[model samples]
Structures are given as C-alpha cells and as structure tokens.
Target: MARQSLAERRRQLTEAAIRAMTRDGVARTTTRSIAAEAGVSLSVFHYCFDSKQVLLESVIEAITEHYITVVKEAIRPRATLRETVRAGFQAYWDHVHAHPGEHMLTYELTQYALRQPGFEHLARRQYELYADTYTGLIEELGRSMDFELRVPAPTLARYLAAMTDGLTLSLLVLGKDAVPASADILDTITEHVASLVGDEPARQSTEVAGGTA
Candidate 1:
C-alpha cells in the first residue's frame, strides 16, 4: 500500500478514534485501541496525535461536521423559505435519530472532559463549536433567503444552538417517549425561527402599497 500523507494519516486516525469512542466510552478508549481500530501501530497513532486531547478534539469536530454537512445540503434554497429552513432542522433531527449512539457519545465526551483536570476547555470548545456552526448556518440562510434578523445574529445562533441541544438531549433521555412529538416539535421550532426573520423585500412591498393608498 502507498504511504499516507500526514493529513490523510490524521484523518484516518480521527475516524478510527470516533468509531472507538462511539463503540467504547471515552474514558475506556485509549490511543492503543484507536490505533488497533485503524489497523495501525500505537506509535503511528501517537505520531498523528501527540495527546489524547488532540484526538478527542478531532473526533468532536468530525462528528459535528458529519451532521452539519447534511443540514447544509438540506438548507439549499427550496421553493419556499420556510420549507428550506424546516428541511435543514429536520435533517439534523434525522441524524440524531439515525446515529443516536454518536449523539449520546457527544454528551459523554462533554462530561468526561469537564471531569478531567485541565480538560475543561474541551467541553467549552465543544459548545463553542455548536454555536459557531449555527452562526454560520444562520448567516447562510439569511443571505440565500434575503432577510434581516429580529435579533442579533449571534444571539439567534446561540438560541438555536441551545434549543437544538435541549431537544436532542430530551430525545436521547426520553427515548421513545419523545418519538411521537418529535416531528411536530421540530416544525414548531422551524416556524418560530422562520418568524424571527424580518423579510426586507416583503416589508418593502407592503410599505409601497400603503404609500400608494
């Protein structure tokens, strides 16, 4: 087999680490185990990731990207603005349902990070990544749909992030209890979020009609 580049090697190790962590709890997973999962030597794992923290961070990012990538695609301009927004949210919800274990591991990783000395930063970073991802998506939706925010972008982003986090955890914790209402819940949130946008063109049209009257 051809040799892997450093970036490729790190990507391989990161994917392997995610599989290991998702299968085994974060506390139980070790570099040796990740290397074995990736079919590489322990030394190769260390070479790619000098510390466990680095590997875990990569896993956090990879998992985030894994779900957000679907959302981004789902958010592509549909015929209706509300449809597009709802599609994005529904896509994320679908991911949570499909990969419940991965979502559960994210919460576990957060708790693990907070308990480990000097590793609290990882938990913070995890949340920050969520907020940042929302911020980007909100901006993208605004640009594509042509609307201004009723609130500050960051405020709206963080609010959405918090709402998603709550809903995801509720689903995971409540299990089947949340299943019946899950789609309806997501639709309600999508409507509330869509309503939070101030549509500039629509407002201008209404103002022009009033002026003519």
Candidate 2:
C-alpha cells in the first residue's frame, strides 16, 4: 500500500483524537490512547499534533468547521422559507443524533474553553459565524416575504440559535425518548412566531377556531 501523506496522517490522527475525547472525555483521553486508537505510534502522534492540547484544539476547529458546513448545506437556496427553517432545525437534530459522542465532546470543549482566554476567543468566533449565517437567512426570508417580524431578523436568529442549543442540551441530559414530541412542539412554536410576525393567518385562524370550539 502507498504510504499516507503527511496531511492525510495528520487528519487521521486528529480525527482519532476527537473520537477518543468524545468517548472518554478530555480528562480521560491520553496521548497513548489516542495514538493507539489511530493505529499509529506515540511518536507519530506527537509529530502530527505536538501535544495533547494541540490535538484537542485541532479537534475543536475541525468539528466547528464541519458543523458550519452542515448547516450551510441544510439551508440550500432552493428551499422555501419554511423549509429552510425546518431544515436548519433538522440539521441540528440529525447532527446530534448521528454523532452523540461528538456532541458530548463539543459541550465538554466549550466548558473547558470558557475557563481560558485564548480558547474562548475561538469559541466566540464560532458562535458569531453561526449567528451570522442564520441571521442572514432570516433577513433574506423577511425581505422576500415582506413580513415585519416582531423580532428583528438578527434577534430572531439569535433566539432560534439559542433555542436549538438549549433543546440539544435537553436531549443530551434527558435522553432521546424524553425529547418533547417534535411535530407538536415545533408546530406550536412556529405558529407562535408566525403570529408575532402576523405571517400565518390561516394557522392563527385554525388555532382560534380550535380554542373557541
């Protein structure tokens, strides 16, 4: 077999470190174990990452980039406004469901970063990227639909971003089965948002009629 290039080896080692951190938590994940998991020698791991902190930081950057790409892909331009919103939430749900270990690692890293100034900057920058992407989409939808949203597009975007994060944390703590019924909860919240923006008259009418009868 052809030998893997330096870039390929680094990527492999970084990914293996992420998986180890995810499964074992930061405190438990060791350089020896990460090297073992990657099927590489400890010297190879050190050559690629220099240190465990460097490996963990690389993992954070990789995971953040992957999430941003996924969210962008989910909000493709062809989708309708409602579909775009749904797609964003669905992407969050799918990502967490598909990679529970990664999600846990994200939380762990976030908490760890909060304690340090340098890591906090990266974490904040990642958050700003997420906010900017979602806010731009919301603004575009508002313009296209000519709706005067109760919350400005930027604010709404922040709200939705925070909501999704809170929901994900809830799922992490409460387990998948304990997550509130998706259809009902999302539908109700969406309706409430539409009502605030005076956007979904039909839904509001139906809700009013239901309440009356």
Candidate 3:
C-alpha cells in the first residue's frame, strides 16, 4: 500500500479525534482511543499531533470550519437578509440536532478553552470568523436597500452570534422540552430585527424608488 502523506494522516487523525471527542467528551478522549478509532498506531497519532492539547485544538478548528461552511451555505443568495438569518439559525439547529454528540463536544471544548489563554485565543478567532460572516451579510443587505443599519455591522454580528451560542447552550442543558420553543423564539427575534431595520414594505418601496428616474 502507498504510504499516506503527512497531511492526509493528520486529516485522518483529526477526524478520528473529532469522533472520539464527540462521543467521549474532551476530558475522556485520549490519544490511544483516537488512534484506535482511526485505525492508526500510537506512533502515527503522535506524528500527526504531538499532544492531546494540539489534537483537541485541531478538532475545535475543524468543527468551527464545518459550522461556518454550513452557515454560509444556508444563507447564500437567499431571498432576503431576514430569510438568510432565519435560515442560518434553523440550519444550525438542525445540524446540532443531527450531530448531538459533536454539538455537545463543541460546548465542552468552549468551556475548556475559556480557562486556558492559548485555547481562548483560538476560540476568540473562531468567534470573530462567525461575526464577520454575519456582519458581511447584514452590510450587503443594508447597501442594497440604501438604508444605514441602525446597529454597527460588527456589533450586531456579535450580538447575533452570542445569541445563537447562548441558545444552543440552553438547548443542550435543557434538552428538547426547553428547545422545542425555539421556532417561536426565532420568529420573535426576526420580527424584532425587522422592526429595527425597517419593514419589508419600506425596503421594497425604497428599491422601487431607486429604480425610477
């Protein structure tokens, strides 16, 4: 068999670690288990990731990237900013529901990262990535309608990001009983944002006026 390249081995090991972490949580995941799950030897695991911290960090990065991709795909070229935001949140909830273990692992790692400065920096970077994605969308919508969004894009982005994070954590802690109401909550939030940004009718009128001589 051809020897696996270093990058390929690393990717394999990282994927295995994600599975283990998701199933076992960060505190319980170990190099040996991850290697076993990946069908790689201990030596191969070490070669790919020097330590548990490094492996976990890679897992966090991988998961964050996956979520960002999902969110972007959920919003891309959607009918309106409100629809895009709602779709993004709904997609996120669906993703978490589908991968409950991975979702829980993410929350666990977030708490762990908060206590360690190095990991905290990585966590903050991921948060910024999410904020930037949402902010860009909001700014684009604002420009299209020739309406200056009341909240600064970055600030609003952060608020929305934090809101989603908080909601996810709440769902995790409270389970389906508490989270089943999320649809209603999302509707309320959408209405509130629409009110602040001006209604669809107003935006449509502005667009029509801009098109006229």
Candidate 4:
C-alpha cells in the first residue's frame, strides 16, 4: 500500500475522530476507537496526534473550517442587504437540516471541550472563530450595499452568532417540525440587522436616480 502523506494522515485521523465521537459520544470516545475508525493501528493514532486533546483540537479546526465555508456560501453576494441576510440564515438552517450529525457533533465537542481540564480554551476559541467569521461577512455585506453599519461590526456579529447558537440548540431539540417557527425567529434577527442599516437602500436609489437624470 502507498504510504499516506503527513497531511493526509492527519486529515483522515481527524475525520475518524469526528465520526467516532458522533457515534460513540465524546466521553466514551478513545484513541483506540478513533484509530479503529480510521482503519489504523493504535500507534498510528499517536503518530498522527500527540494526544487525544490534540486530536480534539484538530476536530475543532475541521469544524470551524467547514462552518466558514457553509456560511460564506450562504451569505454570498446578493442584490439586497435584506435578501443577503435572509439567504445567510436560510442557508445555515438548510445546512443544519442536511448535516444534522455534523452540527450535533460540533455542539457535543464544544461541551466536551468546556468540561475537560486544559481544553476549555477550545470552546472559547471556537466562539471567537465564529465571531470573526460573522463579523467579516457583515462587513462584506456593508461594502456590497455601499452602506455603513450603525453598530460596530464585531458587536453585531457577536450578537448574530449568539442568536444562531441559541436557535440551533432550540431546533436540535425541537426537531424538523419546529423549523418553520424557528425561521420566524430568524426573521426577527434579520429585522434587527435591517434596522442597523437605516435608510441606506433608499439613499442609494435616490443617488442612482440623480446620477441618471
């Protein structure tokens, strides 16, 4: 068999860890289990990661990367700020529905990281990553719309991140039947973002009309 490159082995092991944790629950997951899931020997597990904590950190990195990709696709350039924000929320919720296991594993790993000694930083770092991702998106939205946000970008991003976390937990517990109602909750958030933009859309329209006259 061909030898795997260092990066490939690490990626394989990390994915295996995520699958094992999702299947067996975080507390019950072990290096033995993760190695088995990766189709490698126990020594390979150690070779790939210094410790289980390191492995978990890799998992967090993978989760954060995936989330950024998901959210970027959702919030990609749109014709209007309102539509852009709405698309982001809708795309995220759709992802939750499509990959419930992945989302569930993220939350599970977060709680696990918090309770584990020397691992609490992972949880904090995860939220920081989330805030940064959303903040960038909001800033991009403002640039695309030719408008400025009334609130600081970081502040608004953190607020939206908190709302998403809460809403995700609620949806996970409430199941598919509750998605529609949860959407209404998202609409409330959208309205909040809209309020921060004030009359930028109207002002832009007036500018266009004056320029064309």
Q: Count the clashes in each prediction.
A: 0, 0, 0, 0
lDDT of 3: 0.75
> Which runs of model 3 end up more than 4 angstroms from their true locations?
116-123, 132-148, 194-201, 204-213
Write down the worst ten-residue block by lDDT for model 2.
Answer: 76-85
lDDT of 4 by residue, 1-213 (tens): 899998999999999988888788989989998889999999988888987777877887887677667777777667777777788888788777777787788799889889889989888887888898788887676666666677888898898889888877777888888776866877887788777764467677888999999
Could you tell me the lDDT of residue 168 within candidate 2? 71
Q: Which candidate is the best by lDDT?
A: 1
Q: Whose lDDT is higher: candidate 1's or candidate 3's?
A: 1
Query: Which sequence of candidate numbers ranks them by lDDT, best first?
Result: 1, 4, 3, 2
- Residue-by-residue lDDT tens digits, candidate 3, 60-111: 7787677767776776545665775678777788777667677788778878
Identify the runs in model 1 with alpha carbons over 4 angstroms from their true place.
200-213
lDDT of 2: 0.70
Between candidates 2 and 3, the one scoring higher on lDDT is 3
Clashing pairs in 2: none
- For model 3, what is the alpha-carbon lDDT of residue 135? 82
Better model by lDDT, 1 or 2? 1
Candidate 4 clashing pairs?
A: none
Q: Relative to the unseen true structure, what is the C-alpha lDDT of residue 191 in candidate 4, on a scale of 0 to 100?
A: 81
Q: Of the candidates shown, which would achieve the greatest TM-score relative to the real structure?
A: 1
